[model samples]
Target: MTLKLSLSLSISLVLVVLFSIDTARAGYMEVTLLGTGTPKPSIDRFGPSTLIEANGRYFIFDSGRGVSIRLQQAGVALSKIENIFLTHLHSDHISGLSDLWLTSWIWQRQHPLQLTGPVGTLALSQHLELAHQADFSYRTKNTSLNSNFFPILAKEIVSEGIIYQHNGIKITAFLVNHYPVEPAYGYRIDSGEQSIVISGDTSFSENLIKHAKGADLLIHEVAAANSELLAGNPRLQKVISYHTTPKQAGKIFTATEPKAAVFNHVLLFGISERAVLEATRESFNGDVRMGHDLMKIGVGNELIFY
Candidate 1:
């Protein structure tokens, strides 16, 4: 299926209608952009991090670029973050971790930090601890930090299995498409009637669809502008070989029938002239659009109101 402009416009109109229906939902299920860029390093996009908060407990997905400060933008402090889920070991996603660790320690949280991710997580935790040796040493003397700095639980996930099950919310990690960066995964998060699947930096894969199926939202990474790569950036010609085109993403959503799709890691949403996006949208069949920083999503399928 080709992504169609008419479909995109229709989806936009639908969102406007939905937002008009209930203004309260507009406030619930806060999904904030901690960072929205990729390796390309656009000033508009930070990196690739997302924050999802509901009820009382906070669940943080990938902690990509500027995540520490991004949390401030989301209005969530370090102690509020109960669980941190990493999709892979890519630097952008995990780079902000060291800052998070230090802040959590400085704040001296009462609850233990729940750190879970694919292979190398334990090793990464080790590196974080070592990296923060100076900070930890200083904070432990503050008495408050003494009790909270080192109290953490690390759940290492090498393959697909149950990673988190607690507090009326259960999250499962499934292998995804970003190969060569082995053991990459997408997460299935279910909280009562609210369910969302997050694709952490991946190309189109049936395996991802399996995890994303029947969910309220699918947040997937979009690739570089296809036309530009094919024409302008000769350097990216080699890079584009590994990712998913918007057309392909639309097809995946068409098959998965996700209630709605919010494209992240978007290369050209508000910055470029949008010629490439028009071509990409021509391939997606259902309601499809791109996102920017602070684009919040309310719960429910296809109820994507910007």
Candidate 2:
């Protein structure tokens, strides 16, 4: 009887452990850094794009260069991604928008792509549609794709508020300081008990700090250049002025205190990744990581990066 009781206790403990593991794997939001580069273009870092997968829905933020290729590499079908959120309308940020939109329609997307962004988004969409009219006409006439799926449904954000709420997931857009490119924005996504903040491209905006607080993960942009180089080049200085330095990003990370912070849309001019990390470390003593293309992070009971 004693041996049987001991065996039963062992089995119960094993089941509990298995149950805990399953629980940890379930309902966790997945974030994939599709392209972590800027406008200049690098084979290593394609462009600025992030993929969020939660509740069986796919949300893409910022369709930059090589977005379609990155999505293919990530094993996500173009048709499966229907919602896209744009932070701002910079050339580097929207360069891949037409490709993703057109390719998805060709690849059998049954509905129009739901696009959300700042005030100029609608105009951009209209122009893209006009530009692609010949392609859409040819495909619909020669192929099986429905012309109905060729349109892009765009929502232009005019203010800072909750922009999307569906199936227990809420996305909020807030203003960030990316001026002379006025009306720049950042985004906060919350689903279940997990949250993520994406700072599109900004230079230390207090509004971002307010929305990023207590998020599970914060993906922010950073620009790094040697001070000596900037001293001689006015153009470089102006470019750096529009973005957050590693040190400034560190301050924001410290203020928000997210569980983990990551740097994406990296703009490193004359410095190395080590230099950027060290500069950020000076202000933030939290878990901070440099983002790379195709890097996957799963946020749940604990943060998992693979």
Candidate 3:
């Protein structure tokens, strides 16, 4: 009887351990900073792009320059990604769209690439189709690729609300102030008990704070320049006017109180990453990390960055 009881206790402990591991795995939402640079070309940092994996599905936030290469570096199969959400119609954010769309189709994407963005998204997709007409025809006529997958299905977000929900993953689009770029947006993604917020090129938006509250991870943009350069250059001043300064981002981070805060789309004209972090620490006391290309973060019961 003593031996039997010991055996039963061992089996029970093993079952509990397996259950705990499964629960932790199920609650995780994986995020990868595919590219962490702005319009300025950098060998270390590519253009702005992010990949979010939840419920075994892949979603890309922006298709910036070198996004395909970044995705390859992240070991994400191009053919597996079907949905892309654009923050705005900025050239740097959409320049790699053609490459991603065309290459994914060639790589055996089974469906039309689903693109969700602001008002001009459909028009952009239409123009892209027209521009790539010859290539599409050549591939379909000569290769085994299906012509049906040549077109891109784009949905333009007209208002702020829950834009996508599938397999327990929910994505919400909220308006952000990136004026005079009207209808710009930030996105909040929720899966199980884990949440992530991406602040898409905004300048201290209260709406972003509202949406980002208590999130597992908050990825935001930060821009900084040398004080003398900023004072002398009207162009730099105008550029900074549309973007969130590190200090301003710190305020937002403090208000949102996320489990982890990261800076992406880093645009430091003459300052260093340490300077940005120092400025942000002025207002926020929490841990802040400077996002690097291909950095992976997992949101679960505990925030994990790798």
Q: What Cα-based lDDT does every candidate model obtain?
A: 0.73, 0.93, 0.93
User: What TM-score quantifies how close candidate 2 is to the native fold?
Assistant: 0.92
lDDT of 1 by residue, 1-306 (tens): 346988998899999889765543432455666677776566667778888876567888887777777777766778777788998888988777777766766675667677898888888888777766776777667565555447556778977966777665678899887868888888888766567788887777899887777877778777755464467766565455456667678777877787777778765423352553565567666666677777777664335464
User: For each candidate, what TM-score against the reference?
Assistant: 0.82, 0.92, 0.95
Q: Tell me the alpha-carbon RMSD of every candidate.
A: 10.6, 2.9, 1.6
lDDT of 2 at 35: 91
Identify the runs in model 2 with alpha carbons over 4 angstroms from their true place.
1-27
Worst 10 residues of 3 by lDDT: 20-29
Candidate 3 clashes between residue pairs 3 or more apart in a chain or in different chains:
none
Model 1 CA lDDT for position 259:
70
Candidate 2, 1-306: lDDT as tens digits: 999999999999999999887766554799999999999879999889999998899999999999999999999999999899999999999999999999999899988899999999999999999999899889988989999888999999989999999987899999999998878889999886789999999998999999999998999999989989989999999999999999998999999999999999999988999899999999999999999999999988778999
Sort by TM-score, top down from the best: 3, 2, 1
Pairs of residues at least 3 apart in sequence or in different chains that clash in candidate 1: 2-282, 2-283, 2-284, 3-281, 3-282, 3-283, 3-284, 4-281, 259-302
Model 3 off-target regions past 4 Å? 1-17
